[model samples]
Structures are given as structure tokens and as C-alpha cells.
Target chain A: MKVKKFLIGLADVFRFIKRFFKEVFYPPFEIKETLRQCFLLGNRSLFLILFTSFLAGIVFTKQSRPSLASFGAESWLPSLVSQAVVRSLGPLITGLICAGKLGSNIGAELASMQVSEQIDAMEVSGTRPYAYLVVSRVLATTLMLPLLVVFADIVALLGSYLMVNGINGTSFTLYFNEVSAVVTYLDIFSSLIKSAFFGFAIGIVGSYAGYHSEKGTTGVGKAANTAVVVSMIFIFVIDLASLQIINLFRVQ
Target chain B: MRTETDIIMPAPSQPRGNAVVEVRHVSKSFGDREVLVDFNLDLFERENLVILGKSGTGKSVAIKIMVGLLKPDSGTVNVLGYDVPTLSTKELNALRLQVGFSFQGSALYDSMTVRENLEFPLKRNLGIYNRSELDEKVMSALKDVGLESASNLSPAELSGGMKKRIGIARTLILNPKIMLYDEPTAGLDPVTSSEINELILSVRDKYNTSSIIITHDISCARETSDRIVGLFDGRNKVEGTFDELKKQNNEELKPFFNY
Candidate 1:
């Protein structure tokens, strides 16, 4: 039963992605509404993303201090923190946070619309709901996540600098030079690519869950909850796959 | 015990002007539960047809088929002379411009205000862009539904009747030729339902649009339906003008007249 449900879910996700692609590039693009969704989903998530990434960097530095110090490599803390924040931790944590916020939000919103016949109303009115609802959201998340990750990496690195300063009285300028020296453009690019994929996962999963919601209001709630859980799982899957691709590039 | 299959076929399509919506021999089933079977309807130009059925009797399914929202298992649903299920996505979308549907839930967008909801179809479907014309149209539609004052409110802020009015107003914004209303009075109080019925009549008269209102709200049918068709056991059963049908002596049809 579980395997059957999983296969069905996988197929549904593929179909949703297919539909998004088909309708996304069509004309009469609902540009204004898409911008509104981008503002709502992306800009609205800034505070939560900021708070999570800040805490993540502080915790990472605090946890790693003793081990690195035991190895007598304490001064390397700034570079190490920057590498972790930019390459993985910042984006991963940001993705997970957005999966919770935007996933539940988009899922609940669309699921409620499904229950209320707003979707059908759109369909029969000759306004393509898929183009307006799914494409705009997926595009917003795909474009915005990388931007959010960039913002998060900056905030997290700042938190990491504060942690380093608290531990060994390291000056802000000195910390910055260390981080800049170690963190290459490759690290920045890979983080940006990975976060974009994470955003795609969040948008697609949330939309699929909500769009296919059944059993009315209870189903809407379930769809929202499932969207968060499933989106988080997809984030991890994407992280692993992208890391492998990055590894292939490194090996070459 | 008598199903349409055993004895009745859909009543012979009486001559009505230029059949704009036709559902012929259409049957639909979900799993083993058949919702519609051999259902037939001919909605003529500028006619108000009410389809009456108890809950789960496929009145909703019948309309869904008419609007191309659902495909029948077998048989054809043609709207405005175009076959519904056979139309390509692009073609179906184009066809949708002439057909307006009001959901039983009054499915207003929760994120948009009343004015925005009304403007959605106008902007997209009708391709109307002149700001003054758009404003004038929106106001007229809202005023027609007695909701001109509530134009700025979110759908969540509106009462049940108000939401239904907003739904009808939004449908009107496109100036569609055919309106498919699914249980327009399903969840309202008696007074509100009556008001909705009156609004349906007014909309029909004002717009001269063909309509199929699916409801068990007998009073609504009596008030607005130019012709009332009963759907029973997954097929079209009996149809007549409301008063003529009410005067029928059939024992099995007795339950429907209790209203």
C-alpha cells in the first residue's frame, strides 16, 4: 500500500511539473499577479529566513569551536564558517524554512480554493488557472530562493563573525579577509544553483499537493501538512543529487 | 424502482431556438458508482432551465459535462455547437469565454477583493483594457448584484448572500452568453435563497443569456426556471414548466413536490 501510494505520488509530481512547464511560457502571462505572488512568497519570507540562518551560523560556530581548537586550528574558524554557510548550511536551512512557510501557505491557499470552486471558476471563465497559479508560484520560488540564500549567506556569515569575535577577540576586518580568501566563486555559484533547485522543489510540491486535494476542508489541511513534509524530503533529495553533480565537476 | 434505462429516455427535445447547449446520451461514472447515464438536455438561446435532483443524483455532474469540466464516459456534450470533450485545450479555453459558471460555493478568490474578482474575467477573458470602461463595467456588474458598496471587501468579509452575489457579478463581468449555475441556492437561508432566485431571474432577463441552474431548491426552480427537468437514477427523468410539473399525479415524483 505504501509503495503504491509512493508511486502515485511520484507520478503526480512529474505530471504537475510537466503542466507547469507547458503553461509557464504561454502569452497573456498574468505578469502583475505573478509579481504579487513573488512579493508575497519571497519578500514575506525574509524575516523567517533571516532568523533561521542567523541562528544556524551561531550554532555551527559554537559547536565546532572546541573540536577545531583541540586540533589547534582555532584561527581557521572564520574561513571554515564562511565555507559551511555559503556552500551548504545557509541554503539548506533556508530551503527547509521556506518549505515550511511557503509550502504550507501555498498548499493551504490552493487547497482551499479547490474546495471552494475558485479554481473551476477560473477555468470556466477562460482564465487559465495553471498559468496564473502554478506557474507564477513555481517561477517565483525558483528565482527567489537563490536571492534569499544569498541574503541568508551574508547574514549567517555575519553571525559566524560575531561567534569568532566572541571566542578569540578576532577583529571584523581580519575575519572578513579570512572568509574572502577561502570562499571562492565556485562556492558562491554552487550555493546559488542548489538553492534555486530547492525553491523549485518547494513550489512544485506545495502546488501538487494543494491542486490535487480531496475530501474538502479536512483535505486542504492535510494537503498543507503533506506539502511541508514532502517538500522537506525533496529538499534533501535535491541536495544529495546536486552534491553528486558538483562532485562530478570537481573530479573532472 | 424505475430507472431511466428501464423505461424512460430523456424527453424528446422539444423545439427550442438554436440549441446552444446540448447533452446527449452522456453517461459518467466514478469507479463503479455511475453518476450520470444517458442524460440529455437541450438548452436553447435565452432560456432558463432548472435541473432539479436530490443530492448525489448527478445534477452537478450533468452541468460539469456541459461546461467541459468533466468528460462523459460515453456520449457527447456540445456547448454553443462545439463538442465539449473533443475540443483541444486551446479550443476549449476559447469556447469558455461564452459560458459563465457560478459554483454552489460562490468560489470567490480569497486573496482578491470583490472588485478584483469581478475584474479577473473581464481583464483576461474579454481582453478589456480601457481603465474607464473597465471601471464602468465593474460598477455596473456590482450594482446589478446590489453589491456596488461592498466592492472593496475581501470575499471572506462578505456574508453568504453577498458572496453569491459577488460570484454572479463576476460571471456577469464577462457578459457570457450561457450561464451554468450549480446549486446557486444550496447553502443559503430561505430569504437569501429567494433573493438569489430573484437575482437569477433578473440576470436572465437583463442579459438574455441561456442558463441551466442545478438545484434541489424547489422554490428557486419555481421562481426562475422557464423549464424544470428532474434528474433521477443517473438519467434525465421528467421535464416541464414548473407549474405543469408540480401538477403531475405520478406517485414516485411526489417527493420532489414537497417544497
Candidate 2:
């Protein structure tokens, strides 16, 4: 019974995704609402992303220092840290943070609206709630995630520079020059691409959970929890898939 | 004790105006529970038709079907010359523009101010975008509901009665030909409920809208309905004017009136 329910739910999510694609391209696009959502998703999440990415960069550099010192490779710390931050950590950290933040937000918000009959009210008012609510949110996340990833990448690199300068007095120009030399345009592009996928996953999962939420207060709570968990799972899956795809093109 | 002569038969009177909405032999069920079975109703032009039933009797469902929010399992719903169930998305949306539905909970958008809420349907449905035009229509609707001063307040800040009024105002901004009010006075003190009942009557008079009001509140029906349909056992068991039904005191309608 549980297996059957799970399969049914999975199919429903697919259908929701298909409907989103169909409605998103249709005319009478919600451009103002989409931009408003972009501001909400991006600007509201900026502080948390900055604080967490900064800490992650500092902590990761500190952890790697002793390991590289043991092998007399401490001089290579800038190259290693830059590569990791650009190629993986920046996107992964930002993805997880947004999955927890924006996913729950969209889920609980929409679930509450659903329970309160606001969605029905919108339909009765001759407005397409799916096009207005779901499409704008999904587009916001898709558009904003790449931009957020860029911020996370730059901030993380800055944190690494601060740590390196504190330890070895490495000048800012020298540190950034080495960092830029090691991190190629391909790595930056792939990281951004992965972030966009993660954002799309979070947006759709959260929306699906909220849109199909059962009636009442408990349903709102469940929707929020389900959105966060499902979005995190999707982020990891997309990360693995992107890694495999990127590996195929890497010069061995 | 009411005598047999006092009991009017459950036959509905012929509405004086043309029937604007017609539901025939509609049946709908969810899982194992049947909500409406062979249900039928009609709302005539410029008339206030009340569907009076208990909480679980599918009063809301019947109205939802008329607006194409819910499709009937085996029946036809024709509203404003469009077959509700078979209409395409574009057609259904066009139909919806003519039909304004006021939900039981008011269902105001929490994020928007009262002014924005009233402006939404106008901007989206009618494509009215000029700032002064939006403002004029919004204020007019607010004035109709007697809440023009409360336009800037958030829905959260308004009292329950005020929220309900604003919900009606939002729907009224579009100047719909038909109105479907789902329990216009479900949760309120008697005084507030009376006020909403008055608003319903005034809206009909001012906008000249044909309405179907779903409620279990006997007083609301008595005050607002030009005609009442008593729903029981998933079907309309009786229909008549409130005074006629009150005089009839039929067995099916006794429970509704006795309260």
C-alpha cells in the first residue's frame, strides 16, 4: 500500500511539472509577480547565504591546512581551496541553504493559501493561480539561483583569501591570481548550471507539496516538511548527475 | 402540531424571470461518500436563490459545479449559455468573469492590502491597468461594501466581518452578472450576520446580479433569499419562498425552520 501511494505521488509530481511547463510558456505572463518573487527569493536569502558560505569557506580551509602541511603541500592551499569552492562547495552550500529556506517558505505559504481557499478564490476571480503563483516562483528560483551561486562563489573565495592572508601574509592580488588561474570558465559555468537545476528542483517540489496539500493546519506543516526533505534529496541527486556529466568532458 | 393542510408539498414555484443557471441530474461523490445525488437547481435572472443544507450536504459543491470549479459525475451545468463541464480553459475563464463567487472564509489574500485585493480581479480579468481607473473601481466596490476607508489595511488587520465584506467587494469590482456566495454568514455574531445579509440584498439591488447563496443559517436564508431550496440526502428535497416554506412546515424543511 505504501509503495502504491509513493508511486502515485511520484506520478502526480511529474504531472505537476508537465503542467508548469505548459502554463509557463503561455501568454499573459506574470512579469511583475515574477520579478517580485525574484526579489523575495534572492534578496531575502542573501544574508543567510553570505554568513553560511563565509563560515564554510573558512572552516574548510582550516581543516585542509594541517593535512596539506603534513605532506609539505601547504603552498598549494590556494589552488586546492579555489578549485573545491568553485567546482562544488559554492553551488552545493547555496543549493542546500535555499532548499531549506525557500522550499519551506513556498510550501507553507501555498499550503496555507490552499487551506484558506484563496486558490479557489483566485480561480473564481478569473485568474489562473497556477500561472500566477507556481510559474512566477519557479521562474524566480531558476533565474535567481545562478546569481546567488555567483555571490556565494565570490564570497567563499574572499573568505579563503582572508584565511590565507592571516596565516602566510599572502597578498590579495597574488591569492586571487592563483585562484583564478586554477578555476577555469568551465568549472564556473558547470557550478552555475548545477545551481539552476537545484533551484528548479526546490521550486517544483515545494510547489507540488503545497498545491496538493491535504486540508487543514496539519497539512500545511506536512507540506513544509515534505518540501524541505524532497528538495534536499533532489539537490543531491542533481549534484551527482552533474558530476557524472562534467566528468565525461574532463581531460583525463 | 402542524396539520396536513399546513404542510405545503415540496414542489418548487416557477421563477418569474428567465433561468440564468440550470443544474440537471447532477451527481458527485468523493471516495465512498456521496455528496450530491441527482441534484437539481435553478437561479433566475436578478433573483437571490438560497440553497439551505447542513454542513456536509454538498451545498458548496453544487455551487462549485455551476462555476466549473468542480465537475459533476453525471449531469449538465449550463451557466450564461456555456456548458460548464465541457468548456475549455479559455472559455471557462471567460465564463468565470461573468460569475463572481464569494467563499465562506472570505479567502482574502493575506499578503495584499485591501486595495490590492480589490484591484487584483480588475487588473487580471478585465485588463484594467490605468492607475486612476483601478483606484476608481476599487473605491467604488469598497464604497458598495461600506468599507472605503479600510482599503489600505491588510486582510489580517480586519475583523472577521470586515474581511467578509472585503471579500465581497473584491468580487464586486469586476461587476459580475452572477454571484455565488458560499455561506455568506457562516461564522459571525447575529448582528454581523444580519449586516452581511443586508449587504447581500443591497448587492443584488445595486448590481442587479443573480445570486445563489449557500447556507445552513435559517435567519440568513429568511432575510436574503427570494427563493429557498432545501437540500437533504444529496438532493433538493423542497423549494419555495421563505414565507411559503415557513407556512408549509413540511417534514424535510422542519429541521431548517425549527432552529
Candidate 3:
């Protein structure tokens, strides 16, 4: 019975995505609202992403230093950290953070609105709430998450450099030069591609849960929880799938 | 029994050309629980029809079905000459331009202020872009509701009565041809509830629009309705002028009228 319920939920999410695509290009583009969501999703989330990225890079580098030293490859620390952060960890951490922050926020906001009959009010007023509410937020997340990942990557590398300096006194310039050498365009592009999918997943799952929430106020809490859980899982799924695709491209 | 309209009730039901809203043998259900079974109503031009029913009697659901927000399992709901369930989303939205609904909770956009709340329907339904024009409409709506001082106040800041007024104002800004009120006075105090009832009456007289007001407040029904219908179980059990219904002893609607 639980498995049946899960499949039904999955099918509902697909239906939600289909409706999103159908309503996306209709008239009254809602340019202002979409931009407002971009500002909210991107600018508002910047500080948290930066702080997390910094911590991630510092911790990752500090832990890996001993392992590299045991292999007598301490000089290769910069390449390894940069490769790991740029290829996957940067986007993955950022995606998880967004899934927790933006995903939960969207879920709670829309769920409250739905329970209050605000969505129905909008629909009866001849304003397509689906287009104005869901599409704008979804589009913002899709377009902004990749940019946020790129920004997090730079900040994380800087944090990694500081850790390197603490232990071995490597200059910032040499550390960055090593990073640039190791992190290829493919490494950067593929993770960014993954971030976009992660953002898409978060937006859709959040909207679906909130929009269809039952059981009133308790349902709103459930919506927020489901949104974060589903989005976080999808981030890992996308990351794994992107790695395979990137490897195939490298082979080709 | 008084059969005439007065300061409290709206003017007597004026015989109109044709019905603007028509429902026939509508049946709806959620899971095993049936909400509306074989419910029917006809709303004529400029008539203020009040539907008096018990709680959990599917009053809101019937209203939602009329507007195409909820689909009935069986039966026809015709509004403004278009079959409601048959119309596409775009067409339904076009039809919605003429019909306004005031939610029980007001449902004012919590994110927007009073002025922006009124401006939303204008920007979406009519495509009004001129700053001064939008401002004029917004201000006029606020004035209509005697809330000009609250133009910048958010829905969160407003009192319950104020929110209900603003909700009605938001709908009024669109110049809707048909108005539906779902418990406009549900949570309000008697003083505020009567005030809202007067506003409903005044709106009908001012705009000459047909309306269906769903409420349990008998006094409110007395004030705003041109004709009152008693919805028992799932169908219209008794319907007449407020004065006429008051004179007769109705066993089924005894609780509603305090018989």
C-alpha cells in the first residue's frame, strides 16, 4: 500500500511537470514576478550558500591532506580538491542547501495559500495562479541554481586555499593556478548542468506538494517535509546521472 | 408577514429577462462522502439570492462548482451562456472576468498591500497598464469600501472585518457581472457582519449585478437577499422572500430561522 501511494505521488509529480510546461508560454508572461522570484531565490540565498561552501572546502581539504601525504602526493592536493569541488561537491552541497531553504520555503508558502483558498480566489479572479505562482518560482530556481553553484565553487576554492596556506604556506596565486590547470571546462559545465536539474526538481516537488496538500494545517507541514526530502534525493540522482553522461562525453 | 423590501432587506426580486446562472440536477462527491446531490438553482439578472444552509452542507462546494473550480460528478452548470464544465481553461478564465467570488477567509494576497490587491484583477483580467488609471481604480475601490486610509496596509495588518471588505473591493474592481459570497459574515461580530451585509446590498444596487450569498446569518440574509433559498441535505427545500419564510413554520429549517 505504501509502495502504491509512492507511485501515485510520482505520477502526480509528472503530471505537475506536464501542466507546468503547458502553461509556461501562455500570455501575460509575468516578467516582474519572475524577476522578483529570481531576486528572492538567488540574492536571498547567496549568504548561506557562501558560508556552506566555505566550510565544505575547508573541511574537505583538511581531511584529504593526510591521505595525500600518506601516498607521498601532498603536492597534488590543490588539483585533487579543485577537481572534487568543481566536478560534484560544490553543486551537490549547494543543491542540498537550496532544497532545505528555498524548497521548504516554497512548500510552506504555497501550502498555506492553498489551505486558505487563496489559489482558488486567484483562479476565480481570472488570474492563472499556476502561471503566476508556480512557473515564475520554478523558472527562477532553474536559472539561478547553476549561477549559485558557480559562485559557490569559487568561494569553496578560496576556503581550500586558506587551509592549504595554514598547513604548508602555499601562496594564493599558485593554488589558483593549480586549480585552473586541474579543473577543465567539462568538469565545470557538467556540475552546472546537474545544478539546473537539481533546481528544477526542487521547484516542481515543492510546488506539487504544496498545491495538492490535504488535511489542512498539518498538511502544510507535511508538504514542506516532502519537498525537502524529495528534492534532496533528486539532487544525488542527478549528480550520479551527470557523472555517467560526462564520462560518456569524455570517451566520445 | 412583511412581503416588501425595506432598509434591511434588498429590493424585491425584479423580474429579469433571463437567468444568468443555471444549474440542473448537479451531483458531486469526495470519496464516499457526497457533498451535493441533485442540487439546482437559477440566478436571474441583478437578483441578490441568498442560500441559507447548515454547516458541512456543501455550500462552498456548490459555489466552487458553478465557477468551474470544482467539477461536479454529474449534471450541467451553465454560467453566462457557456457550459461551465465544457469550457476550456482559457475560456473559463474569460468567463471569470464577469463573475467575482469573495472567499470566507477573504483570501487577500498576504504578500500584497490593499492597493496592489485591488490592482491584481485589473492587471490580469483587463490588462490595465497606465499607472494613473490603475491608481484611480485602486483608490476608487478602497473608497467604495470606506478603506481609503488602508491603501498601503497589507492584508496581515488589517482586522478581520477590514480584510473581508478589501476582499470584496478586490472583486469589485473587476466590475464583475455576477458576484458569489461564501459566508461573507462567517467570523465577524454582529455589528461588522451587518455592515458587510449592507455592503453586499449596496453592491447589488450600485452595480446591478446578480449575486448568490451563502450565509448562516439569518439577519444577514434578511438584509441582502431579494429571495432566500433553504438548502437542506443537498437540495433546495424551501425558497421565498425573507418575510414570507418567517411567517410560515418550517420544521426542516427551524434551526436556521430560530423557529
Candidate 4:
């Protein structure tokens, strides 16, 4: 039964993908409306992403200070911060940021639809509900998370850069050069790849939970909470697996 | 008691106009609880059939089954000649092209404006139309519901009655052959309820579309329904024209009549 249910879920994923392509590219692009959603999901999240990345960067720099000082390798701070910010922390942090915003929002929105029978209304209107709800969020997350992560990377690096400058004067040009030298295309690509998976997982899981919700108001709340928790856990798992794959190939 | 319209039998061999929906011996149960037991109904083209019953009597369940949102435990639901339970997803999509529904609470997308809500379906399903054509349809549907001025406003800004009207407008955008309404007049002021009833009747007349309405409002049911089917304990207890049901003062239907 468990295997059957798993296979059904896999099938549902493919079904959703098919609907997604149809709804997204078909002529009546809700481009203006979708852009509005993008702004809500991506642009509005900028400040929260910036604040969290700044604090995280500050803490990382402060903690790494004593360890690198012991080895007289404090100059490695720029490379270390840049690599961490760009590769792992940036995407993870940005995902978590969106998990709080987009995940919960999507859950609440869809849950309300389920609770109020709006989804059924869509189905009866000859409109595919999955195509409209799940696909829109998937596209939004796909486009938004990467953009948000880029913003986060810059904020985190700049935050860490400020911390390094406070401790010892390092020129921006020199610091950036060091960051570019240590971080390869592979590292950046791997991070981005993981973030996309994270985005997809977050959007789909959130939508699936909310769309299938049977409970009423309480159900909506529970769906929102569960979407974030489950997506966050999956994000970590995907992140680790991506890192492993990147490492495996790099070793060759 | 049933209405005069219910007494008029469906003409045999004659095309009942569009024959919008046909349900044959549909039975649905959730686990051991039989929500719908051997239910049968035929909705004619452009006819409004109100299903009246108390809560938990499977009125909503009946509509869900008809629309292919829920599969019947056994029996066939033939809408536009496509067997609902057996339809592939693509086929179901094609079948859905001819049906429309308005939920009890109007189920407007709260995040979107009335225009966006109306436009979402138009753009997705009828994507070939240019923006102007889409705009014309959206405006026309909103006008049909008397919500033309509220187009750009978000759903949150509309009154409950206006929301319901907007919901109807959204349903009309596709120009469906059949419309399913679940408690269209529930939870509204008496005046608003009457307005909705009038609007529903006017809509069917204008579009020549059949409707299956699940409702508890007796006045609304009597006013809007051509046929009234009474459901109790997942079974169709009594069905007749509104005048006929109203005339039968049987003990079994006494309580429903009092309301």
C-alpha cells in the first residue's frame, strides 16, 4: 500500500508537470497578474532575506575570527565567507526565508480555496485547478527563489565584507578577487541547481498539502504550518544530496 | 408539494433542447457511510433543477459527483455523453469545458481583483483570443451579473452578495452548457437572496443553460427550480414538480414543507 501510494504521488507529480506546461505557455499569459504575484513572493521578500543574511554573515565572521586567527589565516575570511554565502548559506537561507513567506502564503491561499469550494468551482468552470494553482506557484517559485538567492548572496557577502573591514582593512577589489578565485563555476552551478529543486519542492508540497486539505479553517492553518516544516526538511535533504553529487564528480 | 413545472414530463424521443447533463443510477459512499445511494437525475438543457434537502443529505455530494470532482461508488454519470468515472484526465478536461459551478460562499479568489478572477479562466481555457476579445467577454460577463463597475476591485472589497454575483460572472465567462450551484443563496440577507435567485433565473434564460442547484432555501428553490428532488439519508425521498410536492401533505414531507 505504501509503495502504491508512493507511485501514485509520483504519477501526480508528472500529471502536474503536464498541466503546468499547458497553462503557462498558452496564449493568455496572466503575465501582468503573475508579475504581481512575483512581486509579492520575490520582491517583498528582499528585506527579510537581507536582514537574516546580514545577521548570519555577522555571526559566521565573528565565530570564524578566533579559529582563523590561531592559524594566522585570517586573510582566508573573504574566500570562506564568499564561498559559504554563494554556495550553501545563500540558497538555504533564501529558501527558509521564502518558506516563511511563499510556502505559508500558498498553503493558506489554496487551503482557503479547498475550504470554500473555490477549487471545485474552478473544475466546474472547465478550468483545470491544478494548472491554475500549482503551476502558477511552481513558476513563481522557480523564477523567484533564484532571484532572491542572488540578492541574498550579495547581502551576505557585503555583510561579511563589512565585518572583515571592521577587523582589518581589506580593499573591496582585493577581497572580491579572492572570492572569485576560490569559488569555481561548479560550486555556483551546484548551489543554483539545489535551489531550483528546493523551490520546486517547496511550491509543490505546499500546494499539494493545501489543495488536498479537507478540514476547514483549522485545516488551512495546519496546512500552512506543515507546508513550511515539510518543505524545509526536504530542502535540507536535497541540499545534502546535491552537495554529495557535486563532490563525487569533483573528485574525478 | 411539487411545482407545476415538475409535472411536465420530459418529452420522449424529442430533443430536450441541449440535453446538458444525464446521470444514471449513481451511488457514492465514503467508507461505510453511504452519502449517495442509487441516485438518478437528468438535467435538461437550460432547465434549472433545485435539489432541496437538509444538511448531510448529499445534495452537495450529488453535484460533486456530476462534475467529476468525486467518483460514484457505482453507476454511471453521463455528462454530455462522456462517462464521468471512466474519463481520462484529458477527456475529463474536455467534458468540463461544458460545465460551470458557483460555490456556496461564491469562492472568489480573494487575492485577485474581480477582473483578474474573471480573466484567469478566460485566459487559461480560451487562450487563443486576443486581449481585447478577452476584455470584452470579461466585461460582458460582469455586466451580466451587474458587477461591471467592480471589475478592478479585489474580491475582499466586494459585499457578500456582490461576491456571489462575481462568482456567477466567473462561471459565465466560459459560456457553459450546464451550471451547478451549491447553496447559491445561503448566508445572505433576504433581499440579497432574492436578488441572487432572480439573477440565476435570468442567467439561465439568457444563456439557455441547464443548472443543477443544491439548496435549502425553499422560496429560492420554488422560484428557480423546474424540478425539485427531496433527498433524505442519501436517497431521493420524493421528486415532483414544485406544485405537486407542495400539494402532497404526507407526514414524511411535512417538516420540509413547514420551512
Winning model by DockQ: 2
Candidate 3 residues B1-259, lDDT tens each? 3223534667765676589999999999998998888999999998989999988888888999999999999999999998999999989999998999999999999989888889888988888979999999999888888899999998989999999999999999989999999999998987788889889988888888899999888888888888888887777888888888988799877777783
For residues A32-113, write the lDDT of model 1, one tens digit per residue: 8778888988888999999888888899999998999999998888888998898889889889999999999989888998
Q: Which stretches of model 4 miss by more than 4 angstroms?
A: A1-37, B1-19, B128-132
User: Residue A251 of model 2: what lDDT?
Assistant: 58
Give model 2's DockQ, 2 decimals: 0.89
lDDT ranking, high to low: 2, 3, 1, 4
Question: For residues A203-229, what per-residue lDDT tens digits would candidate 3 score against the true structure?
Answer: 988888889888589989999998999
- All candidates in order of TM-score, best leading: 3, 2, 1, 4
Candidate 4 C-alpha lDDT tens digits along A1-252: 999999997897677667666777774355655666677777768899999998888888888888998999999998888888888999999998788788888888899889987887777766767756777777778778878887788888888888888889888888889999999988887877788888888887788778877668999999899889988998889888988898897998
Q: Model 2, stretches more than 4 Å misplaced?
A: B1-15
lDDT of 4 at A183: 90
lDDT of each: 0.87, 0.91, 0.90, 0.82
Superposition-based RMSD of candidate 2 using all C-alpha atoms, in angstroms: 4.0
Q: What is the TM-score of chain B in candidate 2?
A: 0.93
User: What's model 3's lDDT at B127?
Assistant: 89
- Scanning candidate 1 chain B in windows of ten residues, the lowest lDDT window is B2-11
Candidate topping TM-score: 3
Q: Kindly list the per-residue Cα lDDT of model 4 for residues B1-259, writing each as its tens digit.
A: 3444533332222245656677777788887888998888888776788898888889998988877889898888889888889988778878787888888888887767999899878777777358788789999999999978998999888888999999989888888888889899888987787788878888887887888889888877777788888887888878877778989985656776787
Q: TM-score per candidate, in order?
A: 0.94, 0.96, 0.97, 0.88
CA displacement after TM-score superposition, residue B184 of candidate 4 (Å): 1.6
